[model samples]
Target: MDHLTFKLGRPVTRTTSQFIVYPAESPDAVRHAVRLGLASPEIADGLLSPGRIRLSLTATLVAQAAPGRPQVVALELPRPGVGLDLRQGSAAPAHVLSRFFGPPPWTERYRQAWAEIANLLRAGDVTDTSVVVLTAGEPDRAAAVAEGLILGSYAFDRYLGYRRKPSTERCVRLAGSVEAGEMRQLARRAITVAESVNFARDLVNTPAKDLGPQELEDAAAELARDLGLKCRSMTPAQLRKRGLEGIAAVGQGSPRSPRLIVLEYAPARPRYRIALVGKGVTFDSGGLSLKDGKGMEVMKKDMAGAAACLGALRAAAMMELPVQLTVFIPAAENMPDGTAQRPGDIIRCGSKTIEVTNTDAEGRLILADALVLAQEQGHDAIVDVATLTGEAGRTFGNVLSPVLGNDWTWVERLLSAGLTAHERFWPLPLLAEYREPMLGEIADLKNASQMGGYTAGSILAGAFLAEFSPKTPWVHLDIANTSWSAADLGYLRKGATGVGVRVLVQLLRDLAAESVGSEARRRPRPRAATHA
Candidate 1:
């Protein structure tokens, strides 16, 4: 069963195997337990020892109890920095019949705590559950709890075969302080975002053999159909005809070929228009400039940028955000073959020509065509995300992603969105001098900087894309480092992390809100008139 089946309800008398979780900081814990009917004030006082709470077990079993009192399990909040340890044995109860949760304050750590809870839930495969989330009645805080659980419950075990088990049918009931209607709305929004993020993660985790350029196109087309969005695609020949040769040249070596997928969502009244361009290198073998075996192991994740855009589009459409969103994915497989475009090759990218200096530097080439396409469509702003450079990985070390852009306003806007979404991004300058190395002797520009070697590789790649959208407000994210995690950390597992989706969705949300406020200010007021 899917992990998203959740409901909201009022707290009731405890059934067998119920989990009563509350903040240790809550005043009169014993009194609260008596009211919930889990224990009498005298018994509850003995159940919790301030010293034992932190030093003892994560969960204490209240086995068979007296006739009147309920036999419910008790879990007191652990001290700060101590994680939730809910990984009970397989022989444990099948369902969480009920829960009494007094969620802690909504801090960054609090958000992470909820996510870790979700991870534990998924790991244990607890079934037919009902979670009572109290304390965080405010909309945003409540949503944070929901997001943490949903995102943490995400697992990519499709290929696990006999080892894989279906997700348990889980339910969460929100209670306390918050109104029922508001809680329901918050839950829906959080679920939408989590579903989209997991969708992107699935795409990234799939192997290249199963998800080539054509398969990626099929996925995008299917999502567009499901979401009622406008979808368009261009074949290799069509790309060449439109002078988008950079994309065609990159995929010429691979038999799977290349295609460009465009997904558009235009609401009845759009407040803002923006284009999202993502690099869709299904497998980056680096063409003739082949990478080592170690470098190519995770090459399948090269298409994570496209996955991010598709995922963001899904959330934006589901939420029905008042924005005109256009997504451009330049899909290709950069494999080395006799037909592949080698170094010293000249390719046309829109009106500009790019010299293939390093065939491994193929992401910028494809993005150049897609960015120009966005510009031709006259988008108000453009944001392109790609797993583009190893230099980015070396610089950030998975802690953050590097972003470079021609416009500070858009750059700052994206950074702000990252902060709100809990994604980290550090801005790098598009230094004018960096552009010189990109200038080519044979073509208008070279894909890689010959003189600079690997110096500022991420910045130089961003500079290459900046050429196509010079006049438009644009920001480029080199997510090479943050897209895939090396090990399971916090709520994120040891695979594709779906980094860019949150930032993109948050950016759209902020833009929509700003547009509404601006329009409100611009609206004309009805003025009282004297009798004429």
Candidate 2:
């Protein structure tokens, strides 16, 4: 792991490199400053700019000179009278500053600044740290910079070789008043949470060859053991005995076999029972309705939801929230084989029969069984997360997860929690009328819709899962857009985003509070009968 340290001192009288900024209209002054700044005879002549500045400084210089020892660019802003120093890589120095001042709406501006800085850090191209000096003397601005730098320096590099090492410690220094100890603690906590999220991403990024259905189940079981949670892993035979046809039929094609992973975290005084179901299609080859080459390239991340659920459970156990939690992972790989279920096959799923209209639509089938199992265990509220449909990506475009639920209040609560977690979600309606199209003439319901396909894919999938949770307040998160990122954003890299873990954690916390309050408000009644 890389480390960053900051120090402060008096400004050096001698200058090395200068970056002069004049009034926006004074282009000539900028040219003069640049020319003087590059005046050293040892420096390349082409770098002496007579007029205007180039944005691609490094690329232009590299193209001009024969490669040897790389030249370092040290930037300095010319200021007279009072002097201040910004130094890094040392311990405590005289008057170290760590404070932030921004717009009146502090948190939003703070987040935006962090987002911008995080994007730069993740780019991996720029080697120099950006130093901003504020003359306004606002304490919050300096605090925000320190906070952003602390959060922005997170990276996911678990797969790196032992021989490889990063050359520099990425550092951002703030020049304002703030307590060093408090800032250090804040930075440590931020990095801890970010690393946990990155761990989830690593699990999602692993190839199906290394992490198949059984392997995923084993991983979950190990996690439960490590956290001291009660865990039970059901084999295909056990699941079959429990009448989990949805999981059995979808997993029949894979040699690795399928499993139902149940993990329980019970606190000493439980407030609420919350169950989370995740679609764990470790590798989705689209089954008999095979996917195209481009579509199959990233299918290893199809288990992203399961990864999030497992990650949330780990965080919850670590945080020790006052909630009884249960996690259900229906692990399977949807592949094409001689024994694979066909598109027209009829399967009984948790007391409800489903006609397989498309073998590619396998995620919902697996989740149906998991939801039924959760409800049977007497959970008050159920939530399932999955990268279920391409329609979600088409609708939200990598920005938002679409949430659908039969209970409007629960959906709203989840939406609010997602906002606070920075995991964006849009509440989608579960119209009772949409159930008509899902009705099958030969079976209880059709897995794929005959009409309104792309427009309502998320809603239809939610409706399908809702069948199993007949009495439980159910929420379905179609996180197809958020699970994989086409580009990096903030602390997230351009791979598995680990979308739902934080949101699910927040939701669990909210549910726990609500359950506690509700129980406290109930009136006591006199006992009518006593049996001895």
**Would you list the C-alpha lDDT of every candidate in the order shown?**
0.72, 0.65
lDDT of 2 by residue, 332-389 (tens): 9999999999999999877778999899999999998898889898876788999999
Which is the leading candidate under lDDT? 1
Q: What shift in Å separates residue 69 of candidate 1 from its native position after superposition?
A: 12
Give the per-residue lDDT digits (tens) of candidate 1, residues 116-176: 6565466654343433334433557556666666666667776777877644444443333
In model 2, where do residues sit more than 4 Å from their true spots? 1-112, 115-192, 452-455, 512-515, 519-532
Per-residue error for 329 in candidate 1, Å, reads 0.5
Candidate 1 deviant stretches above 4 angstroms: 1-107, 129-132, 450-454, 516-532
Best by TM-score: 1
